[model samples]
Target: MNATPCIIKLSHISFAYPGSDVDVLNNLDLTLCQGEKIGLIAPNGSGKTTLFHTIMGLSQPRQGTIELLGKPMRTPKDFEAIRTQIGLLFQDADDQLFCPTVLDDVAFGPLNLGFSKEEAKNTALETIHELGLSGIRDSVTHRLSGGQKRLVALAAVLAMRPKALLLDEPTAGLDMDVKETLINILNSLDISMMIISHEFDFIHEVTHKIYSMENGKILTDEEVHVHQHEHVHRHGRHPHKH
Candidate 1:
């Protein structure tokens, strides 16, 4: 049996937008073990992104508690400390890459963490090299292709060396080769992760376990497999596939 400790624990988490009558997350509970790769799948508006926001402390929950790396998270101060231990990858690479050059963008986080200029640059270069992106170290962020931008965005997050990663739609707009590259990189990393994606094939490729969400709740049956078949209806013996 795997004896990895829990890196993230959310208990009885309930969240609702201010002045809204509905709760996007209701008593949601989740746990991510160290070195575990988990995937969450759900249709649009199923509260998957909301769950990420809550975990990242971007959104406050109405009730319940969150523990990160064995430390309880309560106030903004707690989240401030927790942020360094958890990296978040936004669905859109453009949202995270803003610096003039890829190296500068990847170095931003280390600089903010008080690493010396030389140290930050070195860390960024090492991270870029690890991601096999050294060729574009000085490339303009906006000019890079979609796959390059995505890898650079991820390099920026990895430079911080977070213990866990929360990725939202990491493979949304990638071609086959890019997707394969991402899968290889993710498989090589020894970090815990909670990935949200609609691409079942991609999810299955990288994650060890999978869960489905519905109406702000995670379903109990975690064992999920993708299957395709046609269904025959009684209406004049019509057959259709979904």
Candidate 2:
């Protein structure tokens, strides 16, 4: 048996917003091991964002248990304790970069994590440089291009030195060059991650496992194959693993 640690686990999770009977996350489940990367593929409104929110404690599930950092996660406090360790890249980069300048935005999380002001600034600068973002370090956040904003958002997340990342539609609205750059950046990182994306080729480029969600359940191997994306992933004459 593999001995690697499982950092996150979602079991029989179910949820529905108030006054709505339809469950966005109906008995959904997922597991992430140390250094394991996965690509979650499902159509829009398949509880993808809801699952991310639930993991971060932004949304509460109606049923099931969540495990994080190898322990049961059941409270707002539990979520808060682990929040810094699990970085989430929202679908909209704009939602993440609220600070006036790129440097401030990158330094924000570290500051909240109680880093000394000097340490936070230094950490942010290092992260920005490592991501090849030094060019935009002092730029106005709102003035940056879409791809630039996305990269800066990522830089901010990395400054916290998280153990895992949850990236939602990370490559959306990016040009081919910027998409390639982001892909390369993600590949170089050794941290654990679960990437939510509709771009099959992009997903295949990064993740070790391809997880498909259907009717709110993460399909077993017998239930599906390679994220239900055999056709699209191979659209460019690229073969996928069986």
Candidate 3:
């Protein structure tokens, strides 16, 4: 074993929505180490997004505990500190892009961290360049394409220089070329990540390990290569692989 310290840890975490009878996360336990890429896959309504929300401190677990960067989170202040080190990429890019221009949007996090205005802008520009989005540095965010918005959202998070990233549906609306670009960018980063995506191929390419979720529980934890397979089925008489 490599013995790397855990950057994020959840212990017996359980959560349910208001007025709902069923818990979305049933005593879930998970951990992420530095520099590890982990993938999560599950059917719709299986609580993948809920898990992300819980980790991001948007949804509190009714029981158990959450630790980010080895610090236990017990209150909103604790979570706020945790958020500084664990950046979350919401499924919708619009939720993260609020500033007037791309540069402002990307610099928002660093500015909040008390960086000088010039320092924040420099960091934002460097992150945008890394994502191959420098051309839109000063462009209006609302006028950008869907893929550009997603990249901008990611750039905003990257500018914060988080130790770990919680990404949900990162490649959902991206084209093949954009998806490839994102994969390359993510691979080049030296940070830990827990990515939830329905795109199995993309997950396999980006992650070294995989976990399956069902009924609000993790069903299995295995190496990505172990679960690689081609499933063939027929819609009519023709065969297709998925």
Candidate 3's C-alpha lDDT?
0.89
Give per-residue lDDT, candidate 1, residue 42. 86
Instruction: Write down the lDDT of every candidate, Cα atoms only.
Output: 0.91, 0.91, 0.89
TM-score of each: 0.92, 0.91, 0.92
lDDT of 3 by residue, 144-178 (tens): 99999999999999999999999999999899989
What value does the lDDT take at residue 150 in candidate 3? 93
Off by over 4 Å in 3: 223-242
- Candidate 2 clashing pairs? none
lDDT of 1 by residue, 43-134 (tens): 89989999998999999999999998888999999999879779999999999999999999999999988899999999999999999999
Stretches off by above 4 angstroms in model 2 are: 220-222, 226-242
TM-score of model 2 (CA atoms): 0.91
Model 2 lDDT at residue 238: 66
Could you tell me the C-alpha RMSD of candidate 1 in Å?
Answer: 3.3
